[model samples]
Target: MRVLIVDDEPLARARMDALLKECADVDVVGSVGDGEAALAAISEKQPDLLLLDINMPGLDGKALAARLAHRTRPQVVFCTAYEAHAVHAFELGAADYLLKPVRVERLRDALRRVRQRLESQPREPVGWLHARVRGEPIRIALDDVICLVAEEKYVVAHRAGDQLLLDDSLRQLEETYPEHLIRLHRNCLVPANRLVGLKTLADGRVLARLAGTDFSPEVSRRNLPTLRKLLRVG
Candidate 1:
């Protein structure tokens, strides 16, 4: 994967470039001192990924990312020194972030995620699985989902009065659900719009209540914030 490093600090850029070289599949195609130069390089080189610093002299990284959000832009990984900007980086669809003075292992992990994104198939549209129910893919409406149950490797889509088995994993469904689904566990995905309430059980377990259903799905600790954010409670 071709990568472009965008940072004003000479030393930081150099360090990142050196670390990136350790990955056989990653090629440091260009290094620019500012966002303007980064933009120019993007237009010229069209690198596959960008290791960007949030602050710069000319155009800031956030502004640049906003402009490129809709374009055939390179996947972004914010290499900022500030922890405060982490949320902003996520909001911008950044593949990942590396705090300044990056660790080699972390950078390697970021690159691994970038590779996964590049290799994964484009998400099948919402409810596309309904058509494939009987060698004929069923078309389920997004609103029909009441809850999702994960068992082994498959997710079962439970609607208001019926259920359909989907051949997608929870991770893939997370990407597909986006604004519509809330993650209740590492293995389960729930419809965000269908969530009625969240409660902590006597056993010290968190569960999500789905609208129009008695099902209360378990919420893993790691996915709590994601669910809270989707429920507008975070």
Candidate 2:
């Protein structure tokens, strides 16, 4: 399990880092001193777990967790001195809570729970898709993807500067992430949030445009009604 440690105290973070070496399965990806840094790490590293301290100067653990409500969140384990925050910690969907001066045995148990979750959950529980393109392995976070265009036998994921051809089918991808990607045509699926608006021509032709890009695909007649309903257009 990739673990990130977050705490304002240098000594506490160091102690947790040293003890984590006891578990061969756990790799310490990185440690951050405050919640702001932790958020940045969350975007860059995408760790599977976070050993978080509830109390901090700014953007405390609770606030940080709240900020991550939309994105895929790592399993959180609260490690703090105060016991009063236990209820709030659990309310924030923490996997476990360990008191300060953490014991080796308790840490082991917390890791065990993490292992169980990792086993039961899907590999890309965060909507990330793995694909091989140009003879190189690429990890595509769904957020980075702008759209999926179906080719003859593969689905090409279009991004800002790059594109990825996936071996998987568009049907399965749509079924897996219906909330994020919307089908505009039989061969095209676009990021729901990036879709700016639909434009209709004098001849009753419709095109869907996305933000930050001038590229627009012709909207199919079959999906026009649904797309219009989504955009609140008549």
Candidate 3:
């Protein structure tokens, strides 16, 4: 398991690092003194878990966890001196909370739970897709797809300057390649990274604009909040 330690105290960071050296199957990716630095480390290292401190000068641990609520990676475990924030930490879906002056045994227990949680979670499917473009069978790289839309019995995959017909349904695509595609409507699945913006037309219909293509799919009202979260805008 990859871990990132975030705390304001230098001694606490060193102690945690020392204890982690004794633990098995663990890698310390990086250590940061504040939440802002933690965020940067998270983006860079993409650790599997975080050993976070609750109180700090800016962007405290709990607030940092809240900021990462929309994301699915890098689970959090609170390591704090105060016991008062236990309930709130758990409420934020923390894997575990350890008190200051942490023991090696307790740290190992937290790591065990995190490993179990990670193992039980379903992994997203990757690789290529076999589809047809103008009756020509070609394997499309999943990363090159901008969007997939369900039309009658076929699903159409849109790339930069091409469109291919697929046999799989939108729901199947959404479930199979969750890391690649996000649902904008019942009929539309757009790659999270490919999605760039949302445009409101004169008819008051919101459409999702994707990168590498001009095809804008209609966004449903039921999925508006999800779209906003994906775009990180309201």
**Candidate 1 — which residues are off by over 4 angstroms?**
121-234
Q: Output candidate 2 Cα RMSD.
A: 9.4
Instruction: List, residue by residue over 1-234, the lDDT tens digit for candidate 2.
Output: 899999999999999999999877888999998876785566457688999998997668877665444443478889999999999887877788999899989999998987787677655634786688777877788866778899888788887777888867888888888877889989999866556567898999999866545678889999988887765421
lDDT of 2: 0.80
The global C-alpha lDDT for each of the candidates, from Candidate 1 onward, is 0.74, 0.80, 0.81
TM-score list, all predictions: 0.51, 0.58, 0.56
Lowest summed lDDT across 10 adjacent residues in model 2 is found at 64-73
lDDT by residue (tens digit), candidate 1, 1-234: 889999999999999999988877888889999875775576456577999999897568887676455433478999998999999888988889889789999999999988887667342324444424656567676555666778775678886667777767767777875756677776677665455457898999998866556778888999887766644432
Q: Which candidate is the best by lDDT?
A: 3
Q: After superposition, how far is residue 189 of candidate 3 from its true place, in Å?
A: 18
State the lDDT of candidate 3 residue by residue for 1-234, as single tens digits: 999999999999999999999999999999989876786576457688999999987668887887655444578999999999999998888999999889999999999998997787643324577798677887876756778888888998876667899867888877887866788888888767556568999999999876555678899999988878855531
Better of 1 and 3 by TM-score: 3
Q: Select the stronger candidate by lDDT from 1 and 2.
A: 2
Q: What's the lDDT for residue 28 in model 1?
A: 86
